[model samples]
Target: MEDLAQMTLDLTDRRLLSELQRKGRIFNSDLAEKVNLSASACHRRVQRLEAEGYINEYVALLDARKMGVPATIFVEITLSTQADEVLEAFEKAVQRIPDVLECHLTAGAADYILKVVAEDTEDFARIHRQYLTRLPGVAKMQSSFALRTVFKTTALPV
Candidate 1:
C-alpha cells in the first residue's frame, strides 16, 4: 500500500479530495465549481489521483438494519500457532465467508479480530456453527454483539 503521508498534495489537490470525500457522486463540473477549478482540469486531476492510488474506488454504503443484517458482532480469534502458513490459511478462509465485513491481524490477546453482520442472534448462531468454527488454526474464539451503533463513516480525512 502507498503511504499517504509521503504524498505531497497541493492546495487544489487537497480541495479536490475533500470535496470528493464529502460527495463521491458529485459531477466534474460541480466539483470544479466547489474547488475553483475548470471542469477539464478537475477531471484530469481526479484521473491522475486514481492512477497514482491516492483515490480508491467509490462505493455505496448500505443500511445494515434495512438490509436485514443489523446485528454487528466482533469476534476475537486465537490461533494454535503464529506460523506464517497458519495465519495465511486462516485469512484466506475468513475472506470466503460472506458475513465477515472486516478482519484484521492484531497484536494483543487475539491473533485476529473480525467484524461481522448477521440478521440477529439466531442468524449469528447459525453462522458460528457453519463458518467460524470451521476456520483453520482456530484455538479460541470470543465474540461480542453490538447493541447499537453510535456512528459510522466511510469518508477518510484528506
Candidate 2:
C-alpha cells in the first residue's frame, strides 16, 4: 500500500509474473519468448516492476529442514503500550531477527504477528526468551508451532 500503482500493465505483465514464479532465474530472452515480447521489452518491464517494488530482491528458495531450520513458529505479539513510539520501537527490534521470515502489524487481539524459522524447539525457545519477550514494549508473546506447511507461496495473482 506504500507505493501508488502506475503504468497499468496488460496481460503481458501478468504473463511475465507467472513466468517468474515458474522460474525466477529464467533468462530474459526465454521469458520474452514465453510472453510473446521482445527481449528488450521484457527486460524493461521487469525492471519497471522492480523499480515499483512489486518484485523485491530474488532469493533461492531453500529447503528449511535441510538448511538446519526444521521448526516453523508463528508468534503473536502484544505490546505494553499502544503509543506510536512504543510500536515503532517494537517493530524495529523484531525486524532485525534473522530467523524471522515475515512480520505483520495486525488488527486483532494481538498487536503483531511474526513468522520465524529455527532448527528445533530449543532454538525457538531461545528466540522467544531472548528476543520476542524481551523486545521493547512487548507485554505478551504467544507462539504456535507449525505441524505442517500445507501451502506456502511467494507469487501473487497478477
Top candidate, metric lDDT: 1
lDDT per residue as tens, model 2, 1-158: 43755667689888898889878999999999999999999999999988877678787999998999989999998998899999899888988988999999999999999999998999998988777767899888889999999998877787
Work out candidate 1's RMSD over C-alphas: 1.6
Report lDDT per candidate: 0.93, 0.89
Q: Over 4 Å off in model 2, which ranges? A: 1-4
Model 1 Cα lDDT, one tens digit per residue, 73-138: 999999999999999999999999999999999999999999999999999999999999999999
Candidate 1 wrongly placed segments (more than 4 Å)? 1-7
TM-score, per-candidate, Cα-based:
0.94, 0.91
Q: What is the C-alpha RMSD of each candidate to the true structure, in Å?
A: 1.6, 1.7
